[model samples]
Target: MAALSIGIAGAGLLGRLLAWRLAREGHRISVFDPALGSEPTFDGQQAAGYTAAGMLSPLAERDNSSAEVAALGWRSIALWRDVVAALQARPHFAAIGSLLLAHRGDASAAQRVLARLAAEASGTPRAQALSAAQLGALEPALQGAAHAWLLPGEGQIDCVATMQALHDEARGVRWHWQRTVAQVRPGELVFDGAPSQRFDLVFDVRGAGGRPALPVRGVRGELVWLQAPGHGLTRPVRLLHPRHRVYLVPRPGDVLLLGASEIESEDRSPVSLKSAVELMSAAHSVLPALAEARILRLDVNLRPALPDNEPRTEVAPGLVRINGLFRHGWLLAPALLEDALQACALTQPAEPLVAA
Candidate 1:
């Protein structure tokens, strides 16, 4: 492949990951993030600093997603494992699989969902179904949960850590932080204050770009960090319910990240009381012990959702737009990034997976 100069207009997960791959392939890459100003500062932290409930399984997501979801999800799992292996020493990552459970009344529903998941997960070993007894043994803290399903081989990483690693890994790419991108025209990349930078190809990834045709909505998720009393809760737990699903991510020491509630609100304000009440109640229902846990902090962030619940990559004459990852950003990232790179001609084809 000939060395190419690539310009990216967002430093979020998609932007950073694409830039990293392009740079590795000997592409001259210049990146600009509106979140960062002229004098870029490397916080050595992940972009957005938002909390994520990292659950990755197309089969598990079939209950709320389409067949295409699992197919794309399976394609990304191996890539994620490779990335995680390289960043193993980084903080805020746990490979402990995800748990999908249910209350007594909804046990059958959970089973049905699990069966669908298993059927779709034929080649994907990261997903499994666990009986009620097995579920209790895995998560002793989960009190009175009638039935449970386990995605035993699935895993989660600290969203913050993964983002930080990407930023740090962009050693060869030109990373411009605090730089606000205003527009993208033919052959020119526009930014605020600085002169427009020209590139052979430019990418528009401003998550919430002002494009009406792009069908993307914000699914707000909130989480609270709490310090638990015991040390045995080692794995991540997903308490599945009819109205809501909750996850408990155990950080180092006794601190456990408890979350979250998915609401269809795009407002980027502080978490509402209604959301808090709902989240706390769901957490308590999952594990009654959380009733006595001390609250550390509360966080709320919006995930870019799409009609298809999958990330879309579109290439124009000299520009490409990538977004609509929904809550499966991490789960579906590898495939999405690969698609972006290929559409932008950043990576070579491997026996031609599909048309570009």
Candidate 2:
């Protein structure tokens, strides 16, 4: 395919990933987003990706999501490895897998998760029931756990680093920062109080910003970061409960990301006191060491979702709208990129331009 002009709205995970990939394919790409550019002080709360803990657990997610999502998540994990390598930057892609824990009281919840996983016939690694000794060997930090399941091959990525690297390494692209797209149509982007811009192809990855144009609603997710020094969690750890599931992801600098609150509201307000207490309390029950951890930050962002909560791609003559990723933005992005490119009748570039 010849080099064509492409305009992408929203510089979130999907937008930036699409922009970076298409630019490498020799396309003249331009990106528009209301958020600031990739600056040293870029706030993570501005986009949903940065606020996410970046867990790529297909089996864990399969308990609540569809089979298609789980399958795509597995594929995206492999694609993410390649994309991270090509970026040549440290995004902290850890394939150490994730651990699922349940207290004696919540044993039924864990059993349901196990039953769901067993019903599905997949090529991915099966979840293994961990013995007391095995759980200790795997994650010694997790205490007071009645039962544990180890889902191998699941992983996580540093969303902040990944987004920054995508912005820094993208070539042959023009960036329009702080530009909110009001309308996205085939081959044209209309900005507020500005003239419409035309392109050979247009991608509306505006997420919740697409609003009424697309049947997308904002699903609020809350996360809390803690500075837990001397903690020894190597990978993501999820604690299953009857009401909600809490996860703790280990990050660099002796920090831990605790999250798992999903609310069906578009409110972009700060994290609620009730949610903070619930998340911290649940996480503390699993990892007693976290009780001494100091609170670092509380992040709240809205994930784009449709009524069905499944991601959909709509294609027109020269337009492609990808949205409704919900909480699976990072998990499903790479696979969805492939689907979108196929929808556009384009193939991946044989030689990508990586940062040196």
Candidate 3:
């Protein structure tokens, strides 16, 4: 295949992922993102430290996502390993699966739905249903949980590390951090105060204003951190509820992350007092021991989400719009980027989207 020059906007997970993949395929790539360095903050707090950490779980997401979610997720899991491996510093990958626990009243219904969904996804890797006893045994730290669902093959990646790796791994790609692209024209990307260069393809991946048609509204998610007390569980745990779903992920430095709430509004920065109280109470309900855990930090940000919860990839001749990753940017990035690369004729795989 012939080499191509590609311009990618929005240096977040998807934009960076595509840039690295295309660069690996020998395409001349240029990346632009306003949030990369300028720290020109948005969404109330600084956007520099935010991450899309959760991976894609097909069975777990059956109620909220399309079949495309799993297919892309499986492909991403395989793709991320290679992308991460190529980096000078490999990012941490936890393939220990996700633990989803529902409250007692909602346990049976959610489990039945999850089990049926898992059975339907039999050919693909599946989420295993767990009895209360099994759930408690697997994660003894968890209490007051009536039922659980485990997606054995699903996992998570540190989004910050992955982004860093993407930039570091791009050998020839030009990255213009802190540059806000203000205009889009054929064969050229124009940053507000920078010279514009023509290219063969332009990708509009700007997070905030990238795609207007996508039912993507910003969802505010806040996470609270506490120093871990050496729990033996080696994976991420998500406690389910009707009003708020909480996830506690184990990180290095004896830190455990607790996130809850998907605040649906244009205002992305406000960390509601109501939400915070609800989160702490929910975490305490799951594990009373958490009451003693030392609070480390509180973080809040908006995750891009689509109403249908499906990623949209549109290729219109010279330009492509890739946005609406929703919450699975890390989980679906590998496959989605692979698809983009193939569409651009950068990779000559057997199932190439464009003829070489």
Candidate 4:
């Protein structure tokens, strides 16, 4: 196949991943985003990928999402291994599995989740009902919790590190930072007060940024990072409640990512006080030691969702629009990448433009 000039809108997870993949296939890639940094930094938190906990739980997600999404997640897990190995970056990729815990009051809700997973023949590992002793042995930090289910093969990734490594390693790709794309047509990209640019193919993956042009709605999600001194959770843990479901993902250096608030608005404001209190309180219920943890950061971002909440791909002669990942951006990214590549008819394996 001949190399083609590919124009990608949005430098978020999907955009960066596509650039890294297509650039390696020897395509001349140009990525445009409104975010203000050429390189990923501490202050660079504009994309929704930065605010995510990056949990890759396919079985757990079956409770609310379609089986297709879960299947994509399972596939993405294997693809992530390849991506991390190729990048050689420490994104803290972990496949030790995740836990689903519920208080006595929410046992019914947790049971429903377990039943749903049990009925599906997804080929992934079946969830195991853990006894208190077993749960304690698996995660000693949650010894106080009585009900727990272990979803094997579920995992997480460090989104910030993944994005940074993608940007750093994708050689021969031009990045347009702090530039907002106005429209993406087949093989062409339009910008405000600028001339239109044409490419052999164009990919729209702006996440929530691809609004109006695409049938995408913004669903708000907020996450909080905590610096806990002695919290020893080796894997992601989901605490089930009637009102909201919160998850605690442990990162390197004793840092914990706690979040679960999903509102139906497109607000990009700072984390609200009500959400902070609810998240902190729910987190404390599961792991009491978190009460002493120091607050590190609060992040609020909008996830692009379609009406159906499942991800969709619209393919044309020289364009592909991929969006509506909802809260499963990291979980479904690699599979979506594969689908997009097929839509572009790039069947050959990608070869690196520059040797690593």
Lowest-sum lDDT 10-residue window in model 3? 40-49
Q: What value of lDDT does candidate 2 attain over all alpha carbons?
A: 0.87
Please provide, for model 2 over 82-109, each residue's C-alpha lDDT reduced to its tens digit, 9 standing for 90 to 100: 8998986768898878999999988887
- How many residue pairs clash in all the candidates, one count each? 5, 0, 0, 0
Instruction: Write down the lDDT of every candidate, Cα atoms only.
Output: 0.68, 0.87, 0.69, 0.87
Local accuracy of candidate 4 as per-residue lDDT tens digits, 43-131? 32477887789999999888889889988999899888788878867577988999999888887877888889887664678999998
TM-score of 3: 0.87
Tell me, by lDDT, which candidate is best: 2
Rank order by TM-score, top first? Answer: 2, 4, 3, 1
State the lDDT at 184 in candidate 1.
67
lDDT of 3: 0.69
Better of 3 and 4 by TM-score: 4
Root-mean-square deviation of each candidate, in angstroms? 4.6, 1.9, 3.8, 2.1
Candidate with the larger lDDT of 1 and 3 = 3
- Error (Å) of candidate 2 at residue 163 is 0.6
Q: What lDDT does model 1 reach?
A: 0.68
Q: By lDDT, is 1 or 4 better?
A: 4
Which pairs clash in model 1? 34-180, 36-177, 36-178, 36-179, 37-178
